[model samples]
Target: PYPQHHQQRQEIFFGNGLTANYQARLRYMIARYAHYDHILAWEVFNEIDLTQAADEQLVSWTEAALDFLAEHDPYQRLRTVSWLRERWPEMLALPNLTLLQVHRYIPHLEHVGPSDSDVIAAMLSDVIHLRHAQRPFIFMEVGHHGHDDSDVPGNHLDRSGVALLQKSWAGFLLGGAGTGMSWWWDSWLEDNDLWRLYAPMQRAFSLIQWDDPGLRPMPVDLGSDMRILGWQSSRQALIWPHSRWSSWHNQLLQPGNNPHLGKRFAVTLQSMSPGRRYSQLAIHMRSGAVVAAHTLHADGHGRLQLKLPPYDGSIVLIITPQP
Candidate 1:
């Protein structure tokens, strides 16, 4: 629960007289729970930009709070503030802030596209912009706002779930620290029985050794109708691809109009190590099914081209190295 009035909220967080009290509370929290190894990070607020406090005041307070946490927290756990995209420059610049947090709601507006491609594009844009932060960037909230539901004909229970899934995988492939956490998990995911969508993503992530220092996000071009996002290590790479024109809503509402739903394309690999060759490649669908497998070698310049199978949703490719 939050204060009803903006002024009240501002006073509690930014009041001149409350600084000592706030710092004291933070100290107490660290003292009380710092020993519990499970507590990962300390977030100052859920969405502090919504407060009526002036930008300068919020920034100053956040800096002070983060400083206090850094000094007092025994383990020096991560410090972050979930902030609006409008204030990203200010919040992300804070020296003590360790995580770049973001929130987005897909709307039915024409400009927004509200489609799978649009979602991937938006997330890629966000990761690209926040990459300067060089910290763990995450979408703390993602889903369709209920208030905007009137624009659509019926409930988006299934479509929203698929959108969340796509956003999660795309975010990870595009260099996000983790999957976009869906908003209203109780209503949008659990209540709708859509929680199973996460299982495949979890398994996909488990297959990769994320801690490898050689792995880094690499760009790929799949032409206009398709999108590819992935990362490459010294000898191995992981790629994920989805159709730009396909979305759960499009598949459900206008099936007749989408003849190219599962269109296949030959995608060329890029930015590989020169003179190195990949020994094996496997393509996996969202369900973790191995749709295709090949024992292939990269060309002399270190490029490998593969013909993809027909699939409207997302798929993963694991490129293994030579022994």
Candidate 2:
């Protein structure tokens, strides 16, 4: 808990037993960090349920805290609570709340690897309905303990992240949930044994800047063999392999079956219109001894042949459709 004074420093008064000091603390935060764009929203308590508090109590405190803040600074950006899966709806009804976010433990809770798309879709639907048609909701938490000896190393998180992204994008295109964020800030996990396993996923997810026009997803074919690398429907193209720890290769040669190498490279297009400007496609490679970049183009529809050069470490192919 933040020091009572920090909460009171703003003279905050919540109907749920908040002292004036708590409000002061929130005021101090708004006054201090409002200028920074990276701070998404002012997140309230982590898990009110864990504290043995009832939903009504949590909402009352939230109302008081938010009312105090709004009174002092009417333009507070947005508000959210870090909640467990089942309790999200109870929190979304608050009049001043902006979004409903939940932490869902996919395979971990069920003792399995990456959950299926339908399961994710169901959760997303629940989020959409619970908001009372108020604000956009998101999957604020989705992660598994990679270091757990009984668990599979990378497959769970990888598949789950991919599944969630695909389902989320499809939902948004059809108008479902708002946005999402994985558990968070993996830097601290860097030196741990599980870090190496999670590095690829972290890199892949890092490239997604939902706010940036360039990195935004767009529409494209959901090809069968090309391994549904993450795609943003807004961009209308396939997202490249940006993960550093991926199980892929940086070979510059044309993709063909080679038992000696795990790098099986291929690109497929479901449809295209010739003469229309196509996105500039490129591949990035890094070897312990050398670094390289290659660019290619996509012809109208079907599959286009891409020539790759050989390298040691990992390779990422970026498709930038031309306007």
Model 2 stretches astray by more than 4 angstroms: 1-17, 104-143, 146-188, 192-275, 280-317
Which 10-residue window in model 2 sums to the lowest lDDT?
Answer: 245-254
Across 134-222, the per-residue lDDT of candidate 2 in tens digits comes to 57666665544344534534333343243334333333332334433434224223223333333443443344444544433333223
TM-score of every model versus the real structure:
0.85, 0.51
Report RMSD (Å) for each prediction in the order shown.
3.5, 9.3
Model 1 residue 204 CA deviation (Å) reads 1.9
Q: Write the per-residue lDDT of candidate 1 for residues 11-126, one digit (tens) a residue.
A: 77686533666777887899899889887679987788777678878888888888888888879888888876544577678999997777766654343453433567666666
Whole-model lDDT per candidate:
0.69, 0.44
Return model 1's CA RMSD, one decimal.
3.5
Task: Kindly report which residue stretches of model 1 are placed more than 4 angstroms away from their true locations once superposed.
Answer: 1-5, 108-117, 147-155, 220-223, 256-259, 274-285
